[model samples]
Target: MSHLTLIEQSPDPEESKRDGQRHSIADRLRSMGQVRAGAFLLLGATLAALAWANFAHGSYDGFWDTHLTLSVGDLQLDFTLHALVNDALMAIFFFSVGLEVRREFTIGELTTWSRAVVPVVAALAGLTLPALLFVLVSAGSGYEQAWGIVISTDTAFLVGALALIGPKAPGRLRVFLLALAVVDDIGALSIIAIVYTDNFNPAPLLIAAVGLTAVYFTRYLQSARGLVYGSLAVVVWLAFLASGVHPTLAGVAIALLVPVYRPERREVEHALELARTFRQSPSSEYARAAANSLRESISINERLQSSTAPYIAYVVLPLFALANAGVQLNAEILASAARSQVTWGIIVGLVVGKMVGVFGSTALMRLLRVGEFGPGLTLDRLAGGGALSGIGFTISLFIVALAIDDEAVQNEARVGVLIASIIAFLLGAVIFRISDRLHPSEEIGRTLLRPVDPTRDHIFGPVDAPFTLVEYGDFQCGFCLKATGSVEEVHRELGGRLRYVWRHAPLTRFHPNALAAAEAAEAAGRQGKFFEFERSLFSDQEHQLPSHIIRRAQELGLDIERFERDLRSPAVAARVRDDMLDAEAMDITAVPTFFVNGKRHTGPYDAQSLIRALEQSAQEPQPGSSA
Candidate 1:
């Protein structure tokens, strides 16, 4: 579940139209599984910690206990190695989380209340039940306050777990989980800020408030943002540390104040202007101005999140696992933990409580007509996701450190965290297997991924047409061009009874101009000439150049400036890419792949064959009956 969209890769203006869309490289990179790789790194760290603690318990303890000091001309800061990783470096981790939360609320999963309510309510239930379970199980254990441990979920590991489980086209479920996890993080952070803090100093908080005020206004500044934000962030962190607040809170505070916005059209156009000027007269001055313009066009929140996510995932998180996951397991500690209420409380709260809390609340919400889940997010899949949510690692261990001061108690809690994570993953795997069996998603390519909507789909005929034919076609394909004629013949014979829908499945690897042409159709669609542009591109397929595409738009009486702007917009690129990805997921590797009433057409796609199929499908149970 990620709002992480593929980065926009504009087709080169200098290349021949046949050079095609270059997103195949990006698709290859995406297939390499960055999240899966990062998850493995974290798991490796956790395992290494276990091995070190069990093999050389003294070194594991002694190393983490080593005191480190930072001095800046009489301003001295001190921390044990373990504290430095958890308290200082993890502030950056929290900062990244804060960045995601801000982006998500503004533009990602939680942008609208209607779209967000189901997951938001489910997240609250997930948080509440787990903590209550922990409190009840740990009653009279002298550490019921450690309820925060069960309230959180390790998002990194949760995502990785989903990837490992490999559900078919889990796009909707991923979106729901992303929204739920964002709320879950917010709940965990609240618990940390409100429940665990001590000393309660208001004096330094005034200073922190002042620093935060400065941060609020830093958005208006045009340069040295890195230096400014870094300096101010340190000041704020120090202020919070002195105020007896967990200093990581400063990260959230700073991030919330940092501006987040879509790149302005004017700003992007101006950046392009600077870029053109630089190309005409290559100089350091022009280069710097263009660079700043490009950077300024995008918001700092996005830039900061993208830049830091790698380090946070690869370095900071692994270091956190190393410092916190080193529970020295032995006969005595194992026996003690087995009997410890805190241990069982954590496991039950996570492995059992989280599942019931998340999935049960979501199901109840749907039953009560509170909100809707996107298609494909069945209760069965949610059961699996809820089980995965129980893998509470990072924040769980962090809370263990803060809430339990006794070494023995700390060890017991850590043991519980580790065991719970493993059980949650295994249990989630089994649940997903059962879910997959029941749903039978294995027939992916045999049917449509999502039903066509009149608002979102490109169509030609009545919205309530009795017969529908959907084509996943490439603009540059000769076979697709042939199929279009057959489709026209079928439409002529069928009249308003048929609605033909076009979706992109651009074979960019072989037909470079295909992706660009598809995007051009979308761009033209903004001005009511999509089908006209499609016919023009197909009629003169060999002339499918950047110049040709623009000329076609002009000949169709499209506003040149508006068309150009729309052509390069991320929305346009994402639209084409979404179709491409959808096609890829359904294994639609070739052009002219047709789905007649949600079932893939076989044998031939000639007018006669398509007509017969549509006729037959009219009588069969139809999965893609139009609105």
Candidate 2:
């Protein structure tokens, strides 16, 4: 039996390209996961709470206020239904926040000082201005202590509201808002710890310290046993509860302490070797060893974040909303709240305060040349984002519960949050819609051609074919390999009507051998064997090493010496480099990126979709050409 490597191996260049794409997709998915589903669930819970509180007031209050108690031997805990949801479930929400914060600082957008500056400064200004505005409005009133209410931005609701704008929504805005909200969360958690504690107990504080220390020590353990971490986390939470500090902070603390480093490269290579061995010789022992090796390759923090994100977003957050968002709404209460300083303070602080603070700070940064705005982030869009930041539902409500013991004042604050959120959403939506209309995003179907050097290019099908399909591809890309069959099918079906062109986009950072492979194809083209060599290169789809390339060249009846010379020639290398430069100029980042009739194909590249795009392009009159 032939020995096969369980995991694919590429030259250093190909390996770099593969790693780049993998990390890119993983990071995108992680960020998207935080915003998408969580937003809808939060909105649904908020709306349901509003309906229940108004339509079924008695039941809503009775159910949420019902007392619940837990006792084990000499230890006892007591909480109302609302308290349990806020204190216990919200802790999980904070844990998720902590995970995001750590990941962002370590690897995500905030990894560098440059990227960190904008969001950190924006968040600080956003937090400060809102509090100041609230204080100014309610300075002499006893409710001035509730200034913390407007300091938070409800990330889920804000992201969800932007989702309504569809995919054309500028990604930079979302990223900026997410980073800002995360920083906002850090500040909010700190305030909750320092300002909200009723009393201090040294015994439980010592116990919490000890438990956290135990968690920190677990980092040295080779095995990441979940039960050990879980037990330690519970102990920490319980200790904090007794310590009179918010128990929810325990979740954040534990999240920050979780190990975030993956196994080293050598360890990963060993795991890959073990996997190959297991594949070659099937056995129970080999399987267990391979599984353990593979599992250790990923960080415990990443694994935990992935596993718990959905529950935090969908379950814990929505439950918190349902428990907290219920506030009685009637004409009499509204009339009274309208006159209350507490209500107007929250309203002005969130709506006007967030807009002025965020936009003003960003504008100032740009004016001072301290930081530049991200692509597609214009002044109007920034204003829109600022307005949306006012949707401070979750943490705002949490602060209300902490800051105010008076039922009437709490109700007034909730009413203000609900009303301000609605107004802010409307204002943001209108501003964004107007901005989008004025500037408009780039659309597909616009011809975007780069000058092609016919002498250096590889062309298949008729040169005068009505429609042309150009592909920027790397030989080591799995997606490009999978796309080969679909491309072949499209070629066969389109026949003389379609022409195909291939351009090099080797992704050299990941795929080490990709540049060499492109050179081999160019060398073959030197002897009128380009198509044959290209077909053979992708045919096997498995072995594309230099030795395999030589074999293919020999099989194509080329003089081995001349072929070898051409492969190493500066001319061949330049040809490949030229294609890459063109790809970069066009901002093509990924392989298998296709262009139909000189216009970028934004739709799926499946055979059916490609055919449809070709046919549509054929029917339409060419730009700047008469029908």
Candidate 2 lDDT score at position 388: 93
Model 1 Cα lDDT, one tens digit per residue, 337-406: 9999999999999999899999999989878878756456778888889999999999999999889999
Candidate 2: stretches off by over 4 Å: 1-35, 166-169, 262-284, 442-627
Which ranges of candidate 1 are over 4 A from the true structure?
Answer: 1-32, 72-74, 265-286, 366-372, 439-442, 452-459, 473-486, 503-592, 603-608
- On TM-score, the candidate that comes out on top is 1
How far residue 27's Cα lies from its native spot in candidate 2, in Å, is 15
- Cα lDDT tens digits for candidate 2, 1-627: 000001122223345346545654454456456566788888889989989999999999999989998999988889999989988888888888888888677655566566678888889999999999999998887999899999989988888787665224345567678888888889989999998888878689898889888998887777657878999999999999998999899999988888775234345556878899999999999999999987777878888888997898889999998999988888988887898889999999999999999999988887887763543456787889899999999999999999999988899999999898999899898888888677544442144435333554677877777878888788777777777788999998989977788888785656666767888899899998987987887877577766778899899999988988777554566567556645543445466777887777766778988999888887765441111
Query: lDDT: which candidate is best?
Result: 1
Report how far off residue 160 is in candidate 1 (Å). 1.8
Estimate TM-scores for all models.
0.84, 0.69
Candidate 1 lDDT trough over 10 residues, lowest sum: 4-13
